[model samples]
Target: MCSPEMSRSSDVDVRRTETRHEATHVKARRPGKGGACGHMALCHWALVAAMLCGPARTQRPPGIPGRTAENDVPLQTAAWLAEGRITAIHLPKERPRRLYFTLPKKTSAFSVTVVPCDVPVEWSLMVRTAEDEPPKQQRTYKKSMPEVWWGNSRKNIKVYSNVGNAVDTYRGPAYAPASIYVVKLQSREHSTKVSVYLQEGAGLPKVFPELPPDPQVRVVGVGMSSVTLRWPSSPSVPKVHQSNTSLQYCVLVNLKHNYRGLCAALEALRRDKKIEEVKRQGATLWPTPKAWKQQLGPHRKDVVFPAPVPDGPPELPCVCQGVENTCTVSELQPDTLYYLDVFLLDSSSGSSAAYTGTSARTHQEARPTGTALRDSKPRWVALAPHGGRLLSFRPRGWPPRALLTMQVCSPHQVRVTASGQTQVLAAEIVAEEPVQIWLQGSPSYLIYLENESPATVAEEAIVKIQASSAYHRQAPVLPPLRTVKSYSKLKTCNSVTVGWHGTEERNLYCVYHQQLDSQGGPTGLEQCLGPESRSDTERAVCKYFQDLNPQEAVSTATIGGLEPGTAYLFDVYMVRRFGIAIKYHSKIVRTKKDC
Candidate 1:
């Protein structure tokens, strides 16, 4: 990155270097139609004399008193313009023959132009009129087919390079006013070689300034039935001279004080037009005062109020749901007196107004009660195992097994007795929240039912199981298979770890071992191998489980100490806490003898 100081110096150097050179080509003119000036038109003697003289031959140029040849001093190069040197002299079509010139390259960088008549532009400064002018600067860039360079406005101006060879025609004024402007060719590698050209009378005609923008207006707020309007903040401008450069604004408002009155008026207009589209939708919209109030929000003071809620419902239930912004009113007799309030909201004006109207009505029949629970499906009561405590009963009717309605309705310990049988189930009721009671069987079948009424005596509304042994059937369950992995063999002995996984929620594991005869039948399997081989070891058995390698799989037990080349029978069983156990026997594996 270039340092700020270096950058500034480079900028100044490009515009102010004192190298001056003579114009390379002699001046010549090419005339077209009448009053048409060509690229080198100033070179014509007649035009040159016309530019230097006053039309009436009476008024002199602003600075000259006596016409002297000294005023025609040799013109300076664009770079030497800052030392108070004239680059070119411009002539007015109608005259006092005004003259205009600008510092050369300095003018090229901006939208600067020198008009022969010297009145300053409005809303912008006139450089000549200001005494504190800063030193001018220029920046140079390498030329390309489509040359993109920054102008004085800091906006890029595209100059087409392919148009002319060695000679570039500038379609637009290169900023400054002058009959001649000059630029030098710096060598390809920054070598200070120089060249010059006189480019006076080479620009197109100038254009005028554009028109101003439209004003901003808005509807800032809207209520249930009203609206507010506003406009953006604008700066005040004072009337000035004869320049077409000023702006102005205006405001207006319309209001419909009462909502009913507005709605009625709208309805009346709609009827006169016979417009079906003007009819209200299926539901009548009678917005409540509260709804209108809420719609106005904090800006309520600036809006029109809406009509109040109508008085009536099927039964005018103590509690009811109302329309979004509206409130509900109850307890008025048929044909009672009521008033409606409407508001007008003008957010733009920051103002509001309310209007009121009266109305009367008659009542209608009451509505039906809403549904709470459906009755098509059988309600789930409870599911439990046999021999476990029966928690509670529901509906308190005959058969008494269907409905699961009662959740923590009574203590879990509650019991009912009937027909010489005492109900043994109890429930635990938790306070504040819903609780559940699971039922279990006691060796018999039972049916569930409900009754509309219950008997006062224990004999009435009685709940009883139809069968005494309805709860004893064993639930269908599967036994687990025994598994052994990571087997190892040593001299005369084989070892393996045993374990199992089961789906039965009540299953437990038990390991067993035995020897097989030649016929593959167990032989003397019950013989004691000491407590080390004991499966029922709660009484006494091995002290510690065998050590396993890090790479070994995890299992329940490690079995060792087998006869070399002998087949063995190993089995594991799944046992339930209160039921029978099933064994899952494993295939025999012979031991290897190498020791």
Candidate 2:
């Protein structure tokens, strides 16, 4: 008997041959006639032929159902076939069967698998572009193989060979919607049953709902250093989940003085190029001024005034819940234009959309311009004897030679005293119904209102003071020359050391500073002195003078809590014993960028 031998032929026909019967069949002993066993051989050959050529049936593999035809279709026609469906194909002994399929819109990737049932037949697969006519051969594979193809267009595709119970996946290039694809299967054997699965990209959204539009915003009020914003509630769109319940809003206030120029430059760039292209350039798009030394070289000798510092954390947006729909943003610069952007936030998705709001400018505070004497309330003091009260008047922002007209109305007798340069000018009591006095060169004066009348008389009195120029309409005296000799600044990352020299002996020296913009103009006043009192400006000046020695000449004050990489203008003034500013000096310095 002959033994079965393995065949290495690539053709599928090699596995099915009549030589196996000749090798495994046993010979029967004939009767004594010794005739040839050709008849028995003929019977056995007929049975083997019947078993191989009879009606062929194949069972479906596990996890896959349905049957697919073995017919060839036009490549363009198959491009529209539904995806994710298993199609069965019968391998023929002749030409390959071409199955055309189409990828859905926005299909990023695709996969194809071929599972062979019954016999493992040698098959070839080729992926081709969809065409009106028959597609030309691009890639070919032999034997049972699974493969996936990827391309931007349906022009040329990938191919695989010898696929069995294996899946091939490919991530196609980004293609337009509804591109065509085709798969060709060919084998050297007939009646080979194979299942093919085509799955498009996953994670594609089946249904999408519309989102609500942005809410309309309005500016309710704008104060000197704060702004109040209000917005209407947003309604959810149809077919979308209601987001109003979980919605939140935030107010983004931009210091317009600092960003307006940059925003204008960006707008010009947008006019020249696309906004996306301009954004790609990043920070380069914003116009940055020259270095501080270069920009302020010409104006270095000019005097700079002390500016007000910002109060709280800068750049912190004001946030409010959706239900309130209103928010107040504070700690803003006065007399400054500010741009406001309101955004609606979705808590569930963590998404935000901007609202339309108009820009606003804060009102400037009431301040003295130049050489103007403004009237202010008197400082009340409790004096000894009969619980009497004294009214203290400090002629702030008044010229040294300008006289002040003082009027006092008290039920009891009133005594007025004026002093200057460590000497009393006058001290006298008036018995008239209203007392009046004219005084000059007195930094400050005190009025002693004594309750010397009957006990029924009240202890309170009324005092009114006005500048002599206001009543006489005469030109006021020019301010006295400043006592500051020289000034210098030493700046660190977050602190500044200011040292100055005074020429004359005075009451005290006070230092004030404010933040400056790129152009050396004051952005706001920075309070390095201390917390403000009832009379903020007066208290600041008083605290500085009172804290220092009265006769100190060389003074150095360090101001901390300053922002890094910022420029500031420091002013030093020598105040007289009566609160008169005799001399003043200013210097500009920039802090270090890093510690």
Candidate 3:
């Protein structure tokens, strides 16, 4: 990232460079239909040349001594440009041009863009409010079909690239109460024609509307390393006025400040960033009120904003069952104090509300092995000496394998699948004696058993089974064996339109954006953007999600806001039942150079 001071210096250097390349361009005369420009066209270009650089040819204006184009220089260095007009300006190599605009209102915002005629452009479009220059430096990319790179600094907001960035656009706040803003185009090594489109409007982010009320959250239960929480899925709003806006949830724990205070502080921090951006880029045409600025932040130097929760466990997830707002935070330390917070986020914009949270402590590391009677008892069955019985194995909902431990109340023969794999040991049908069996699968698995032969057995065969599972023991569920596939629909400099194929007909699939590191790819979980990514760069954004059941097989989304010449990973995840996002497929796409 280039600093503001360095970017401003680069803007100032355009002045000295422009003078060395000062020259006039005239249309060559071609005798044909709609022929070359006439004398009127020469005068018009001469006028524009007079306003920008170079001298206009005058017929010595009736004895005006030495007032000829031969020695006369341009009368003006900079010209007055107004809004609501499109101007096509030509910049000579190493030369730059500056145009000034007068804002109609004191609080008007400004927008400017340059449309280059050809590729591999070296000219930059810079807009400086309350200053005199164009700009360059750090680049942020966003695009349509033609990719555009933009730069923001303390002095100006510029739409340009150093080498080959097709940055011809900028819309941002102008300096407040200042009537004049400067637009300049600087060219390096190449002369080019760029059409400048300009506009003005209100572009500041400082609206203080009423925020919705917070949610009420409570601790549902606590385990040694996990805590279950429940709260209202949404705020209690009137049915007639209730919105269908989807909300995102984030839980913060182990903070120095209380949940409410920390939430307020975060809000203040966001406003502070907005204020800084506005002031730095001249993004506000009006100054923030003194009281508003003072009230916008915590305003305490001693109060430190803590870093994000460290790399210990998985991110806290808010999974909704139905209308029940319940979630479990697992993989926590036992016997540790925790300060919990649940933030209800409404939109991609960082606006959120932190509900009041209840602090809960986890159980100690060491506890008695067993004491109280079991809430559920395994059913014991008596079998005839030669009888065969088929028993079902219950699944542990959260685990990949449904595991059951069997204790032989009496000698018995048993056979069951292990870890979804077939491992037969001491099977009465295959072997002879009845031993123990372990079965695993989801929903449930079937355990095959038979009483010992009459020659080896005497009394009836008995067995007891035990297992641990999620809160509910459900019937087995068979996941689709098919695969999800992704392909590029269109590729551009700063965006990639992608489509997916071959997903389960009944599955819901979501696409996620992952910006890869420049070298090869992300090295660890800290840098990945998949569902398991803990990186801050992995935003809580779902670009495209669809129920493939009712929709067409191909769903596409043009993912923008990507950097030029960078690679990105797009992941397609199938949302299995119970809100589990199982990654089905991933595609690595690299964008072209914006030039």
Candidate 4:
């Protein structure tokens, strides 16, 4: 039951047919016929014939063509993709279906959403529109669209492609007078069914007509699970567009299509029995990041981004609302492409003015919560009472060497360690003086800044690193990190106050305390909570003072109702939307005993 328009689903795990295996029977198109294969989960394409025997629903096994002029079902009524039959084994396969529909005349914008009923399948969509044949810098809005027949010549043809239904932009009044849209759906083994939605609305809305161009944005840096973005704080509004209402930038993050299939594929690979033994030992799926890289070689440039599953906490998802131009969206899926939209909104009128859209891919591995530097530049880092800063930079050439110049105030010392290196470097600075050091090259260097100033005082230092040749150096903004530092400041016969540093950017945290046994190990479940309130069950237990408590200081909490002269351990954990980081702090302290 294969049709002529199936592309590889990057999971090209070529194998002999197994029991009810999926994607085994996809129909691939002929090599010389269709368009270039996109680097995505492509499993469907349209096999359009130039003739129409009847109305729009009369779709027969038509020959291969791109867009035809007759009998397209006018995209009128709204349809819902719900109530699908579960795919069963031994069922006859369904051919990939292409539903052609023409947008109504005077159409401004619309969006397409295709969701699979069961197992995920990549669907294809194309809209034949017009794009400028001229260079982008010179291209400007003409009074009207060029007078040309659709699909008649190469200059007249510009196909907007939507690889999978993670929602294409609420874009386009369209390039030409009549933009014909077509959606290709695949019926693979598991249900081979997907619900397609065709409606008119803005997803990542195109710029409004006559509105001034939206303010521009720049990418500061991209880490594994976070993205740092900077845009203009006060984007100018035209006199006509400006009103009494204040304008602010609205930033929305949407998931991209590139990493969706790869996220799915790498998850399946993790279930292999061979990797099972190694899984229990650590954070990595394989023995090392290098070994994990080797396993994903079959996927080529894909499969590195492993999106946290069940589901990611929404992308429109996360509304990155800001009055200032800079913000970092954290807790994002690693190795995934994130579509970002920054627009100016008139808060009083509740209407949007100008906007810009862009996309960036996150790093494969989640980096620590610190100012991350990819370029060799100067950075000023503020030390939060024993906090650390990581200086990440590139080298000028092979056989590497890079120069670092650091300035620290009097009574402060800086401890520097190169991440992923054999040798470490450290230096101390005299008050009001600058120090210079040469660092061995690596992707990043971890440097901890410490000051002899009072604990309540925070210090800022100027650091400049020269890796590659550069004309001008820019400063870095270091985000905070959760160190293993903890303190038990106040204690009584029955209570004690404990605290640990929590990440200010990601504030969700949990602190747990349990009484330790004579050997300093966690005692039985019952004795852990209380000597009097013992547990009847034999399992060991750990109790948290605050579980995912957002409002509390989260960094510190007081525990009461404890046994006298008892030894207890306190631990701090940073809670994330998908999962929690490693135990940041675990220390044992003694409760004071009454005379």
Higher-lDDT candidate of 1 and 4: 4
Using Cα atoms with residue i matched to residue i, what is each candidate's TM-score against the true structure? 0.17, 0.25, 0.23, 0.22
RMSD to the true structure for each prediction, in A, is: 28.4, 28.0, 32.4, 28.8
lDDT of 2 by residue, 75-193 (tens): 22122235555565656665455565655455676665544543343444344443333223423322111111222123554445564322233334433333345465655544544
Q: Candidate 2 overall Cα lDDT vs. reference?
A: 0.43
Clashing pairs in 3: 114-168, 173-282, 173-283, 176-285, 402-440, 402-441, 412-434, 413-434, 443-475, 443-476
> Model-by-model lDDT, in order?
0.29, 0.43, 0.45, 0.42
> Over 4 Å off in model 1, which ranges?
1-494, 502-508, 519-554
CA shift of 314, model 1, Å: 53
Comparing 2 and 4 by TM-score, which wins?
2
Per-residue lDDT of candidate 3, residues 305-405 (tens digit): 22232222223243211123577766667776666666554332223345677778788665222212122234445567776565544444446333243
lDDT of 1 by residue, 22-85 (tens): 1212223344454346444544654565565433233322121122222111222112322222
- Best candidate (score: TM-score): 2
Worst 10 residues of 3 by lDDT: 143-152
Candidate 4 runs further than 4 Å off: 1-97, 102-215, 219-228, 232-319, 322-325, 328-595
Ranked candidates, highest lDDT first: 3, 2, 4, 1
lDDT of 2 at 281: 28
